[model samples]
Target: MPDRLAPLTEALLAAARKAGAEAADAMAIDGRSVSVDVRGGALEQADRSEGTEIGLRVLIGRRQACVSASDISARTMAEMAERAVAMAREAPEDATIGLAEPADLARAWDLALLDLADPAPEPGAAELQDDARRAEAAALAVSGISQCQAASASYSRQRVFIAATNGFAGGYSRTSRSTSAVAIAGEGLAMERDWAAESRTYQSDLPSAEEIGRLAGERAAERLGARKPKTGAYPVVFDERIASGLVGHLLAAINGSAIVRGSSWLRDAMGAQVLPRGLSIYENPHRPRISSSRPFDAEGLPTAPRDIVRDGTLKSWTLDLGTARKLGLKSTGSAARGASSPPAPSISNIALTQGDHSRAQLIEAMGTGLVVTSMIGAAINPTTGDYSRGASGFWVENGRISHPVNECTLAGNLRDMLMRITPANDARGHLSHVVPSLLVEGLTLAGA
Candidate 1:
């Protein structure tokens, strides 16, 4: 309950200065997690972990090096700083390697407004196991489910603090609770499996285990008679569950790191139309109770809402300090990092504009196509935007789902795909990526 992470970060920064580094930053994270899994109506696995980790990044001249350790002792902090400084001395000079200026650092954030950490006490392993068991029982209760493969419940809490020689210092804590279930339908080679899961910042906000499990069972039963559809060019609807992947590809294309390397398909598309007219991609990092919501980035810079794509045009690239400097642009405050790694450009919460039509309405209008509920592998060409992936879901005919389909491929260029999408107003607001189901036209399907 005491402030454990802040003192560790302060000590780490002090050690870095003592080790003769020109400048440095430190991060300390303390985390605890408990998870329980149930199978065959019995507890199959239970695990718990608690630990504290400290990381130091030291800069000498234009070079920087990072080191991390789980040992929280004063001696280890000093040793980590010394080792980081030594590594920095031998590293290649990069003008972009530096900490944020004091003026640029975030100050006076409202952690309470974010409501990241749940106020309730942590659930015990017995409670988690009970949740898992209930989920499994609910899945087995479904009519067509052959078996409940696995059901799980978990809770995690993490406290993170960041400090730098440039006068940046801030810390926050977050908690997550989740429940999931996997159900199998049919028998032998005809068996199909599917899962349902939900996570929330607060345990009270999480959906009931029975609801998650029943959904999983229903999904598996829906895939019982899957067969490959005929090969041809067809319209495809990426279901709301999997639609985020399509938008994720766009996020990657506009990433500053990819742009700086000139390896992204959209590297030269800053002002070009990337989405259909009237569509936009927006990011917000301060949305209360969302897992990715943060007042400040890993680099201690303030994060704010921004439109990555505005009215169908590429408006901004996701950037951290290093990547922004390399591209002669200002940082987007999108930096994210782990204890053992340097900060890199990353998105927090993003949403694609929802359309007026519902998912059912879109399917009814499609006439004949595939409704892709799940995907397996990818063969994306980052630079050229060529995209292909294994897909499985329902085959639609006469504007109605005819049957389940599997073992098929969907191929198209990402750039072309984005330009031809029709969004459905079915995005779940609770998700970090609030992308609605997207319908794409003229994609080549490889199947029977």
Candidate 2:
């Protein structure tokens, strides 16, 4: 715990109690971020910012109020508490809004095992600019590449402390570093764009800027002279990079808040077979080097691994304390929040089980279909599971990639599409959301 943040949180909690609140929790987050962008072989934009933010959440019987401020002075803390309590008195009552009980609070945990932050000194602006320049240069080196769109590098560090009137208190620090490059091919109406980026808790884990840039340039060049495929029902294979979106839908549907409100497509899907047999989606928050790993959540709850989808069946809903209480369930230790808002249920470090076939083998298995490499917009029905998206990718014919295709709409029902998924073995290992390329059979494709 940072010296300044912990004391600030304790003071806010004290102020809230003195202001006649029955219960309260306080949070303080101090963070610093730096970013540099390069374009056309010149420095384009640079930014560096740092600040401390504090929030107080007070409960007056069933009513709750949350107040936040960037100022951490003593006077601001008193005013925040006073205002929070006053607002709570006027707000509508909610039976489920309260802090976790003392028995359920995480008392002690080893954050070192999570390995969230890098101990290295912060990278200077010059170093970040150099990285951006290198990425841009590498992207422009690729054959058939028209030009590099933008290249950038960024770093951030944050320290968080949470304390409550109840006996819960904990803090941790995390750091992130990233590099990205976007490249374009062709010109005017025929142009296409693609990008590559990587982020890691430790800078050492990030792939080389040159490698990231080269991959972006190649992806863009591959889509040059894209033509639309014929309109028909065909299998669609989502590339590994974007395949996680499919799983993300399931995650959203199973969120405790959505389920409690009866607004999720998967509300009645518990214990139902949601995925192909032999596949499971696991949530392991303790994985090292990944950005989502955390020993304790924002609400001071110990996080542990669980099988969200077990043996292809929908097993659990992601839940925080409040949502879990509303759903008549226990917290899954997935609470996440910022200084400006209340806690919410969220997932961390997800890994879908991989299959034996490689991406190429899956493409071959697809036979005649679409390999959707990128998607633009989404139109999804949360209650009905209807999903449609504008997509662009390569067309497959006779078990081989024929040419790039664009101006297509891939439409399918989420529940039906995921039921027949064929996974490939090409999931990026270092990503927080680890899902393989998925081939869904019998989807409607509208093109041209």
Candidate 3:
């Protein structure tokens, strides 16, 4: 398609300069998506969308403003630039507002090696509907599954281009295929539901829709007849499915934006031990086929592998240009931006070191506690790291699962929880966040 998005970004930059912008950056994204959902073993919904979006950021001295639109006409481009320049003129000055210097821009990349876009033909809506219907049928086949809530299959392809006045220009495309299902067990007031989903860059890599549905059904069946456990201080094992959330909190604490605001628990933890002694967290943006992989950040900076936490110690803050400048540190090339916003720090393709033991082994090691499969809500104190969340899972006694439990609260200090975590070797490799199941000690569980 004659390089559709690049020309749009180039035209946007040209318009910005014509509109009296001292400097500017532009991004254009073109995307198409299709989804099919099935309910009661029949097609319930089918949707498709195709569009192009353009964004412009113009700077006047130290002030900057951003504008975005779905219209790609020349007239809209000019109007967007004019409005952006006018807004910049009225905006408050920020010393950190500026594009990367020419020398700092990514000079080259190997998109072929990344394999982000699958070469295979897109699946048709009819094919997707069949997949969803098969998933629903499989869920219903499970022994104790009362109903299949919904089953879906979807595909998306997006092309993105970024250009700046500082001579940085690049574009890349990505594709994803996904299948998901939700299953319910029991009925009425005693009902319980669970879900399973899988996504991949190449459709060939995705699991069969029937497999996902069966997993969902089995999990929901396992949750039947759940009740509350006794309140006490006990060890807790976070399942691999939800363990990434715990690591995400640590990532957020080290975000330069959070650090700059002095609102993070790890604000003063630089070079200090944050995770357990043998654990480390690594960010690698070049991982092939991973959804978060990118060769360059939003500001045109080249991305590379780095250790966010090494040997349990806090190593580096996630940062973009603005936050790095505010912190008096160098950018980690971790910037991400949407069509309507400016660049901000964000991590991609992070992995926590896995342990030698499996998830079942960790469960055995915990003796008596909870194996938290799912959680809801939170009351976290960001500054102090005090954490409380509603949780549901199976209760363990003498290192064996006794029964399912729900409507309970798990409370602990994140700082301490992370420090004592024991990782299990059960992380899925295809995921962007390769965090394994984690066992934490001395948490207060409130139940009936």
TM-score for each predicted model, relative to the true structure: 0.99, 0.99, 0.99
Candidate 3, residues 7-89, lDDT tens digits: the string is 99999999999999999999999999999999987789999999999999999999999999999999999999999999999
Report every candidate's CA lDDT: 0.94, 0.92, 0.94
Q: What is the RMSD, in Å, between candidate 1 and the native fold over all Cα?
A: 0.8
Off by over 4 Å in 1: none
Superior candidate under lDDT, 2 versus 3: 3
Model 3 worst lDDT window (10 residues): 1-10
lDDT, candidate 1, at 243: 99
> What is the Å distance of residue 375 in model 2 from its true position?
0.4
lDDT of 1 by residue, 134-219 (tens): 99998889888999989999999999999888998889999999999999999999999899999999999999999999999999
Model 2 agreement with the true structure over 34-112: per-residue lDDT tens digits: 9999999899999999999999889999998899999888899899999999999999988898888888888888888
